[model samples]
Target chain A: MSRHQVRVLVVLALAAYPALYHLLTQSPVGVEAETLLPRMDTMVALLYFGLFAVSFDFISGYTGYLSFGHAAFYGTGAYFVVLVANGKIPLVPSGTPFMITLLCAGLVAALLAVGIGLVSFRLSGVYFAMITLGFAQVLYVFVRGLEWISSNPRDGASVSGSTHPEGFEVGVPFVDGLNLAIGPLSGDTVTLLGHTLGTNAVSFYLVGAVVLACYLAMQRIIHSPFGQVMVAIRDNEERAEAIGYDTFRYKMGAFVTSGFFAGVAGGLFAGFRRSVTPENTFYFLVTGDALLASIIGGFGTLAGPIFGHFFDESIREFLSPAGQGGGLLPYLQTRLSEGVLSAEVGGLTVEGFIEAALNGHASLYVGIVFVLFVLYVPNGLVGAARDRLGGPVTEKLPDRLWDR
Target chain B: MTAVADPALADAGLALADATPGSVFAASVLQTGFFAGLAEFLRPSNLAGVLVNGLAKSALFVMIAAGLSLIFGLLGVLNFAHGSLTMIGAYLGGLVMVVLVGGATGAWARLGYFLVALVVVFAALAVLGLVVEVGLIRQLYDSPPIYQILLTFGVTLVLEELVRIVVSFYGLQPISDWQEALGTKPAFLARQTTLGPVTVRGLALFEILLGALTVVGIWLFLTRTRYGLFIRAGSEDDEMAAALGIDVRRVFTVVFALGSALAGIAGALLMWDPVWGASVPLAAETLLPAFVVVIIGGLGTFRGTVVGAVIVGMADAVTTWWFVNVVTWTWLPEVTVFLILVGMLVVRPQGLYGVEEVGGH
Candidate 1:
């Protein structure tokens, strides 16, 4: 197949994922009261995170610059949107349209990224990582200190304001009645094609559309001539410089571009959750999550991290509690507690043992899986598939995935 | 070292000297008011307290960073689990304190029990290091640095969760119970003691002494032992050392063990103080400052590690003091370390003592 055919197929696949997942998990009951709604919600959330992971791969996978501070940009975008919506910013009025605020947030993040890149890109390898981390730390502290940003009005500014309280509406302009239901919204359900859809399901389509656009734009950028220069810089900066390309400028541009998309992802996240916080948006662990997704998906593949996160989120959801839509662990816990199995095992209650062994430890298993991947499947699943398929699949995969 | 000789100090002195009669009168009035706070802050005891605290903190950073530096130098592997090792040591020490030392009646007996626990902690971590090296790390010896980093990071997460699960299983909460169980009665370490114009805490003094001993001991071991020579040789060129019949694999194992032992000992000692006791979040939190220490001191250099730790610790201490007292910018102190790190990277990426790396990327 030609390259263009593969690109179109990838886009079609991307568009099909949410619809297919929604349909596959659909229940006989209306979607509003359906048990599968939570699962759909998770998949929709995965798309936004996939965008974040893709942005992360742009700098890290292509440039070989592992940014331990990419969360700085993500957090910037999140805070920007929420702060504007809250009427905290002087320039933007409160209850402004979500799209305008999101764009402004992306712009702010892009500008900040350029400044950070100028200072950080000077150092390479581990030093670059440390400095970027340091920059993020600075921002984290700075934001945490702001009394106005995180305080409750009742208890005054001293009350923790890590999460914004009053949720904002995300809606289309000129559409008076249809506010996009991005969360566990109340009231009536929207119906399409005689199928009832809950607020979260509607929000899923909205977020999925945004995520698709962002991914296409990013993929186009990665395949452009500018992307060629970025890959060149990543491979050999000195050689790229020797060729009179002004490597620093190229790097700075890539960094800003990455920051802008990361911001967009962050904005989507804030809108979906209807809240943003330093812990959620700005933490180094957020960057770590993106890094994990990119590595597992196949770094530099652009589209691979999307699937990587899908796998990750699905596993975590499966491991979650029953009320939260988990299956295996929760089922086992219920059976043990109900005396469906022997409570006593070597004088230890089976239920208690299960709780002790598995309660809140799913992330630990994820970490272990990450290590195993790094050690054995360094090129990730995409590369592994190409290798196993030998010829046909290899030819169809992105050039960057197999280029090295 | 003279106040007048320092350019900034000279400028300040000149400004004071240039004060007009009216300004002098105003200064005298202000001295009793705004200047009073400054004068009290400059008191010898207060200044000594800050430096002592700074030294104690630096000692902790140095201990953790020393282990990290040693591992990185010897194996070219940046072990992200170094913090996890330290945290495990702390938890084990806490158990020893609660289970063993709790049974002791006398202060002397308790002290002896604590000392024994430190050795046990070191031994346990050494064994852990051996297992980790042989079972997991050995397989990735020829892998890229990123793989080593990711593997160690995975170890860190797993170890942190394990610590959490184990601590909870023991029916103990972090900070309060762990600290009460681990520390000695009379709580001498946590209490401040005054000596004439200087004031210091017992734990701070102990930590400083321990830090000094650790640095000296490592130096002597490197300069005076056969194993140390082999480690240095292997670190320089593992293939060459192997060719020379140095048993490089054994050296690598020993190096990892030694590094973990240092972390274990540090963790055990830190348990002496109630404030810095090992907690799960600590394993993750310590990773950055440890890296900052390694980078600022010049990676893989022992002297550089010590210097870097001291600098970072001092900056933290001074900033905390200033922010709390002088400016009241509460958030600024927490970030001062990162600012210093960024500044250092921008000015000198090789660090103060590091040789310029050829084709560094």
Candidate 2:
């Protein structure tokens, strides 16, 4: 098939999965509740993040310099979008539509990326890692202070002050003791290009759609001269510099580009959730997740982070072994139990014993596995796939799982 | 060399310089700054109380971060899951203490409980560290340090949620039974020493003594022995050291073991004194400062770790004392540390004492 055909097919496949998942999980098809509407938005947000995360793969994984501090941009966008959506911008009368909020989120994140990328782009490897990590942490802490902008009452606006607090103090009460304004909400049925599409399914599809766009953009960059320069920097900076490449600009571009997706993801997250809080954004772990996905999926490979992202999200749930044998063993146990039942020998049942053995302490096991993965499989699933596929190291395989 | 020679003297001047000034200082330092300022701890009687608490708090952080610094300096792996390790140890240790207190029918059982629990923490952590080394860190040994860090961080996330699950099942949070169990013997500040109303804790003496002993043991282990020399050598240039007939692989495993053991030991001690809960996310807090200490004091410098820990401990103690409730400004602690780190980075990037090693570009 042609590249465009392949791209269309890829989009179809991705769009179909969430709908399929919804079909399998949610009873009855597409009769959404008001509360459930948020989930649709949230799915969109995750899709946005997924797209952004894949974009991150371009700079971090493709370039081989991992940054665990992108949350600065991500969180900045999330918080900024909420501020903009709520009309939290000073001298502005009120909030904007959710769409506008999303734009502001991306713009602000991209802007912040430019600023941070300027500073952090200088270092590489561990030093680069530390610089980025430190800056993100500083930013996370700084935003927590911006409680006024995020969801603070002292920002000359309160949800209750805007509308009225029924029982509590303000608007929609958030997780950590903050409330939102009643209704300056500028939402107008989730739409795209004047099409009155089914938002429930389309929201997630839009996420995939955006992700595909990001993937293509990233592909273009990775193949472009600038991107090749980034790879050169990653491989051998000294030689690159000696051969005379202003590697700094390349690094900055990658950093900012990586950050742009994260910001987009953050904005989507805010619009999806309809609120933002320090609890969600001000965490180093969130940044870690993106990095983990990129690494595990395979560095510097377009298809790597997608595999990493989905695999990470899935593995944490399945292999966790904490939540009652949720992964492989549980499926086996269910099937096995269909045939017969075991009598309790001691104080514990067979089920209880199995639960205690595996599910009881999932983190302990997950930790062991994570450590084991690093020790054994450094290049992650994508690397393994590449090696087995028997192609040139950087080129895609015939039916490459990572590639579209 | 001042306190380097006399460990006892080192404990005094570093009584923590509470530089924030008065009540504003106290509030900004501790979450309980309000109660302490308004009533319980601000009185003349409580000035001694504040000093005693401040000293103890400093000592606790210093000791915990010291071991963490050792591990990071030697291994270059920031075990993000160290705090969880500490938390697990504290929880288990507290359980033993509780069982001992309740079922003290025989003295053997009581003694057995303490010994067994100590062994449990140390052994568990050592094995855990080994597992991590063999499983994750060993592979990343050749990759960029970020891979190592992220891998550990992934473990930390999974482990923390798992811990929450385990705790919820066991009917506990991170810090519930620790205070009561460890603080069984009420330790008030001894009123004898009248140096500006700072009376030291009887327990504080024990902590200081232990800290000194640990410092000495580590010093001897690294400086006066073959294995110690191997450790120092490996930290300097692992490839060259391996080339020179030292089993660098074995050294990596051992260092991880030793480092993890130290973390476990710290957890055991922390559970009894101050670190029973998740509130003191000891790993993250101690990890940063310890890394800073390891860097500033000189990476992999055993002597440097001590000096660095002392600096961090005193800073933490004084700031914690002066700020918690005193300043009521959330940004102060972070800002203070950021400033310290920035200053250190500008003047001494390899750390205050660290000699940049090979393998890290």
Candidate 3:
């Protein structure tokens, strides 16, 4: 299938899931379709991957500047949106729409990127990467010092019941087929589609929309003429300069664009989770996620992050034993050991054996996967798929991942 | 957008005015090519309270930076987990010490026990670092440098959570009977000297010497030793070094080990510092400041890192002094580095003394 076809299918699939869940199930526990979306954590995981993938794919994928501090933008946006939602900031309005908040967040982070880019752009390669990281640490410290930023964020905590705590309210309410009774300027309750759709579903859908919007915009940037210039500069900076293409402007432009998308991702994340702390907002892991997405998905390709997001989040989730009885290895054992009758056909229940084999190291599974991916499958899912298909059907994508 | 590789290379002329410590000498120091400006040495209590703080802080930076520099230079791979490695070493060292000392018998009673702990730290971390290199980092030597970061990053999260789990577990399951019934308190100074205008801790001076010795030792190891030559050769051209019959793989594995050992040493030495303070079971402040010192000095330059460390240490002391005694400034403490980092990035991108990665490096 072509890139466009895959995109259409993915979108249609996402759109269909919630709608189907809406009609079939009329609220599980005063619950609704949004809350009961299959693997809600997986959806959140997708948002996190999508955000970084947008910005990282631009510079790392397109421009070839291996930045180590893209999290600065995401964190900045996250802190701002989080601060506003918690009524911590005086400059911004509290409890604003998630979309408006995302724009503001993007703008703020983009502004910071502009300021940082102005001074640090002169240093090329490793120096630039280090400078970016150093500056980010400074930002991290700054955020950590803000007592306002810490608000015990519910890590995508689900709200299935009709009655939430008095303090709990969805800041960005996606009210449809259900009435949301607002108590003046105090708190807003979301009765999503027939059931009282809790804050989690509202935040999840809000974040999903923001992440999708950012991803689409980044796709456009990847195909833009200016973005092409950024890639040219990455390929051979001096050559681009020699060819009279103002390489500095291209690099800076990419940096700003990347920051803008990163901010959108952050804002959405902060608002979605209904809280933000320094640990959650400014994690190096978040930066790593973006870097991994770019590397694994195949750099300089629009479809790469879409593909990379699936692998980085879904595969890790598959490996992870978070509140689950089995992981990929366990499932594998069951699949091989029990075939469809692993419990019924294989005629044996071996959940305990699988657990014992795991040996209490969930991260070990994640680490092994990461190491193997970098070493053996460096071009990532997109690259591997492209190779198998004998090059990209899209003109914008490179035959090789390192076209930049 | 302001994007420049080295704004320090392109001089940002933001001059100061009036009578202050740095104002008069600043013109000649920054404007003139001569390295004439002194680091504004200790004057208040005569023993370098500020200077010693600065110096010890420099050592801290040197400890982490030297390891980071070695890995980056030799392997041509930026160990993303270097910071995480420092954190791991610190927590591990702390756990060992706490397990020993926090027990009824006390850790200081058995000095040999401490030595054994050091050996354990070295072995464990060295093995861990090698595993990282062989398992993940080895592939990037032939491939692009970008993937090394991603791989290390993947490892970093796994390790951080693992350490968090381990540390949290140690709290639940205290090391059983770690105390060896040796009521020994190792030679930690209960002495402070008031000399001339400097107020110095006895331990501070020892740390300064240790830092100096480390720098001298590292300098010799890099420039004068055979291993040092091979490291330089490898950093310059790994392909060439390998072709010249040097086992680049072994060199890399050793470099990773040495780096991990240095981080371990840093974690151990930190026990004697003032920041650890009176009655804290475990401290996390060490790693936060470690990054500051690394950034203040350019990444990869050991001596520059020492200078950066000292610069921050003194700044912290002086700023606190100014905040408490003079201006009553709360925000000035954090701004010190913000101002300094911008000044460093804008004025000297290779740090004060970091030799720029010459040519291919």
lDDT per residue (tens digit) for residues B128-229 in model 1: 999989888989988656667778877887787777777877776643436555555335655566656666666677788888889899988987999888
- What CAPRI grade goes to candidate 1? acceptable
Best lDDT among the predictions, by candidate number: 1
CA lDDT of every candidate: 0.72, 0.58, 0.59
Candidate number achieving the greatest TM-score relative to the actual structure = 1
What lDDT does candidate 1 reach at residue A395?
A: 59
lDDT (Cα, tens digit) per residue for candidate 3, span B1-361:
0011111111111121111222222232233222211222222332245455556556665675667667765776666677667656655555565566643443346445556556777677888888888776776776656667667767765776566455434443222211221112254432554446555565566567767777888889989999988887887678899999999899999898888677666655554443432111212244445555655575555555667777876676555433322232233455565567756766776667655662122
By summed lDDT, the worst window of 10 consecutive residues in model 2 chain A runs over A164-173
Instruction: Write model 2 residue lDDT over A1-404, tens digit each, in one string.
Output: 33345456656776666555546445642332211222343345446556656766777776777776777777776766656545556643233444445555677777887876776655456655665667676666555543355334122222222522221111122332332221113222334576443544544554454456667777788889988888898788788889988877778888777777777677666554555655466466666666666666676677776766665545444444533323544554545673233547666566655555445354455455555566667677777776776753344443464555
TM-score of the second chain, each candidate in turn, equals 0.85, 0.74, 0.70
* Stretch of 10 with least lDDT, candidate 1 chain A: A152-161
Q: What is the overall TM-score of model 3 with all chains considered together? A: 0.73
TM-score of each: 0.87, 0.77, 0.73
What is the DockQ (computed on Cα atoms) for candidate 1?
Answer: 0.37
lDDT comparing candidate 1 with the true structure? 0.72
lDDT per residue, candidate 3, A1-404, as tens digits? 34465567667776555445546455543232322233444565566557767686777677777666788888888777656655556766564555566678889999999988887787766556666766776676555433233422223222112222222232344553332222112234356567654443444454566567767777777668887788788778789899999888888888998998888777656544545555555655467667666656766666676566766665555545535533455445534655432354243244533433343454555565666777788777777776776776343343243355
